[model samples]
Each structure stands twice: as C-alpha cells, then as structure tokens.
Target: MVGEELVGLTPEMIEASQAGMKAIGAAIAVGSTGLASAAAEMAIGSAAVGATAENKDVFGLVLLLTVIPETIVIFGLVVALLLIF
Candidate 1:
C-alpha cells in the first residue's frame, strides 16, 4: 500500500478502499477474541486438568469450565462474519 495515491480517486476505488478497511476490522475482531480465549483457556484448562486428576468426580465440572472460554471465539467469529458481509 506504499506510494498509493490519495488524490483523484474514482468512486469504485474509494468503495474498494472502504471494503478493505472493513475486512481488516473483521480480522482484528476475530483475532483479538481468539487470542483472549486462548489466554483464558491456558489458565483455566491447566487448573481443570489438575483438578480432574485429583478427583475423578470433578471431571465433568472441570470439562465444562474449560470449554466456557471457547464461547468468546464463537462470538468473535459471528462479529467478524457480520463485518465482512
């Protein structure tokens, strides 16, 4: 995008530029949330694993807790899709 002209641009070119910005926004949305989810899961999942190892009966609860972080990624994907289309 270096050396790109800003002046004397046609309507179609301007529209295309806006569309590209939207795509970048969508990518940021999904990527940031995905990273957040990963970080949350890193701590929660490790703890869950240890908890489950200590008591077999706690496996179900830990499993549920481990999976809850993933919901943020789903929401991010939805937002990204909405931005793109």
Candidate 2:
C-alpha cells in the first residue's frame, strides 16, 4: 500500500524530512508559547495587574523555551543558504 511505499527514502529525502520536522517543532514552540501567553496576559490584564504581570513572567519563561526549538529553523535556513551558495 501507500504506507509501504513510504517506508524508506533517499538520504536527501531523509534530511529534508528531518528539517521539516524541526521547523514544525520550532514553529509550534514559538507560535504557541508567544501567542498563548500574550493572549492570556491580555485576558487577565484588567482583573489583576499584579497577577497579570506574573503571567508576563511566565510568558518570558515560555519565550525562553521557544528559543531552543526555534534554533532548528535557523539551522535549516543556514543549511539551505549554504546549498544555494
């Protein structure tokens, strides 16, 4: 079936797949953390400035978590650029 056909790929295809996965993970981290926390902060901002500020701190932590994953996209971009030049 189609599953068997996709069981293996060439080296280039494998690398591309890895790069795509990495980019996806990075996107989720950056997009989810940044947007979710920002929205949460916005929602809570009016009720309690102090607690909302604490949520901002959590947002910062989430942003930090996003960095490592985001590096994956950077690495992919570097490799792609190198290939182009």
Candidate 3:
C-alpha cells in the first residue's frame, strides 16, 4: 500500500517475517506444554473434588489458562496470513 504501488514485501520484511516465525515456534513449544500441565492439574483437582465438582469456578480458570496456548497458535496463524497476503 505504499504510493499506490501495492508492492510485495522487501528483503527486510522477509527477514522480519522469518524472525517472527521463529518466535512463534518458541512460544508454541513453551505455551503448549504449560497448557497441558495446567489441564492435567485441573483434571487431578476435579478427581479430588469428585462428587462435589459441580461448581465450575476452578474448571473455568483452568479452561482459560489452557486457552492461552491455543491463542499463540492463532496469533501465529494470523501472522502467517498477513505474510501470505
């Protein structure tokens, strides 16, 4: 969108894109494992609570935390889409 050129990306843009991809990869690795552990903890807690686990307060918190990992992937996809376009 520069000067009505609608030009494609430059070398610097490509490099920045590569760097962003690397960062996203790192984030996914760290985030996914964290989410998995948190979910496991939630499962354990639920098992402990057993019959009294009808209340969703703890479940909701764990669900939100688990979603953080997926959000990183979503953000990575958005960046990839931007690069493609």
Candidate 4:
C-alpha cells in the first residue's frame, strides 16, 4: 500500500509543483533584471559624474543618461508580474 501510494502521482501534487515552478521563474526574472539594472546604473553613474565634472553645461544630458538604466528594472517588474499572474 505504501509503495502504491508513493508510485502514484496525484493531481494536487502536480498543481503544487507547477505553482512552485512559476514562483521560481518569477523570482529569477525579477532578480536577474534587478542585478543587471544595478550594474548598468553603476557604470553609467560613474561616467556621468566624470562627464559632468568636465562640463557643467552637459549636466542635463548626463542626468538623462544616468536614469536610462532604471527602465531595465521596470521591465523586470512587468515580467515578474506576468509570470505570477
């Protein structure tokens, strides 16, 4: 009886596994993109600081460039929501 129970795959168990997988995928999507965005921002921020130091007039352009990496995180959040829902 124990062997039979262990051998059979139940519908609830299948559903639980599917839910776990979906959660994992969502976490990965959000985490990876967040990390990428952080790295991009770090690189761009340093470059922007240097550029701003060299020319005060280019501050606006540098600020725009520095903010661009934030979109990656926003896209990541969208992907994670899609996976969850």
Candidate 5:
C-alpha cells in the first residue's frame, strides 16, 4: 500500500506536509483574489476617470464604485486565513 511506501515518514511529518499544503492553498487563494481585484480596479478606474471628467459631481460616486472590487481581495484574505487556521 502507499502507507507502506511511506513507512520512513512519521505521522508528524505527514501532518506537517498537510499543513504546508494548506498554507500554500491559502496563499494561492489570496494571491488569485488580489490579482483579480487589481484587474477589476484597473478597468473600473479608467471608466471612473472618464465619467468623472464628464461630471464633477459624480467623482465621489465614481471613486466609491471603483473601490468596490477591493471587497473581493478582502474576502479572499478571510478565506485564506480560514484555510490556514
């Protein structure tokens, strides 16, 4: 069996590996979300600039809308933390 092949590895080692893998997964989750947030922000920011140029009164609203994509990164961090802990 696979277990027999890994006889030299202690349970602690196996556990450590599992933990490392989970940490990697967590990092990946956060990293991916951060990338997505950046991309979304770029698109939103360009549009916001154009919109703001057209209407000074809407600048604040446009700014708020542009930051909405940041929530995705926040959520990703939360999920990553959950995965790690």
Candidate 6:
C-alpha cells in the first residue's frame, strides 16, 4: 500500500470533469454569440431608425440589415448543439 500513487483521478472523476467542461463550453458558445448579436443590433437599429426618419424609401433595406445580426446567434446555437450531443 505504501507504493500506491498518492494523487490520481478515478474514472468517475474524469467523466464528471468532462461533463462539466462540456456544459461550460456550451454556455460560453451561446453566451458570447448572444452578446455579439445584441451589440450588432444596437448599432444597426439606431442607423435604421435614423435612415427611416431621413428617407422612408430605405426603411425596408435597413430593416433587413438590422435583422442580419440575428443569424450569428443561430450559428452559436448550432455550435452548442454539436458540443452537447
């Protein structure tokens, strides 16, 4: 018994640690994208409002541009899904 390794991880400990890491990874994936999407929306939304006020004709195009940032969140969701399952 004296020669036994004093410090080492058991199989269960390794599995638990891996699971926790995966959860953290998934959270980070979703959280960072959500923040990016919000930041992009803030800039685009302000510009779109200003353009609409100056000239009504560009409202439709501006609206489309504002929504483009949302796609970034979807990509993050896909990454989270891949990580989880």
What CA RMSD would you report for each candidate? 3.5, 9.5, 9.6, 3.9, 1.4, 4.2
Q: What is the lDDT of residue 47 in candidate 1?
A: 98
Residue-level lDDT of model 5, residues 10-68, one tens digit each, is 88999999999999999998999999999999999999999988898999999999999
lDDT tens readout by residue for model 2, 1-85: 9778878777799788878877776666555665655565554544455544667656655545435444544555565555434
Model 1 regions more than 4 Å off? 1-6
* Sort order, TM-score high to low: 5, 1, 6, 4, 2, 3
TM-score of 6: 0.78
User: What's the lDDT for all of these models?
Assistant: 0.92, 0.58, 0.61, 0.89, 0.95, 0.92
Tell me the deviation in Å of residue 31 in model 3: 1.3
Scored by lDDT, model 4 comes in at 0.89
TM-score of 1: 0.85
For candidate 2, the 10 contiguous residues with the lowest summed lDDT are 43-52
For lDDT, candidate 2 versus 3, the one ahead is 3
lDDT by residue (tens digit), candidate 3, 46-75 = 564653376656676655554555555555
Return the top candidate by lDDT.
5
Query: Against the hidden reference, what TM-scores do the models get?
Result: 0.85, 0.44, 0.39, 0.76, 0.87, 0.78
What lDDT is reached at residue 83 by model 4? 79
lDDT of 1 at 3: 39
Worst 10 residues of 5 by lDDT: 2-11
lDDT of 1 by residue, 1-85 (tens): 5437656788899899999998998999899999999999999999999998889999999989998989999999999999898
Could you give candidate 6's per-residue lDDT for residues 1-85 as a string of tens digits? 5336524768798788898898899899999999999999999999999999999999989999999999999998999999889
The deviation in Å at residue 10 for candidate 6 is 3.1
lDDT of 1 at 16: 98
Model 2 pairs in collision: none
RMSD of 5: 1.4
CA RMSD (A), model 2: 9.5
Q: Scored by Cα lDDT, where does model 2 land?
A: 0.58
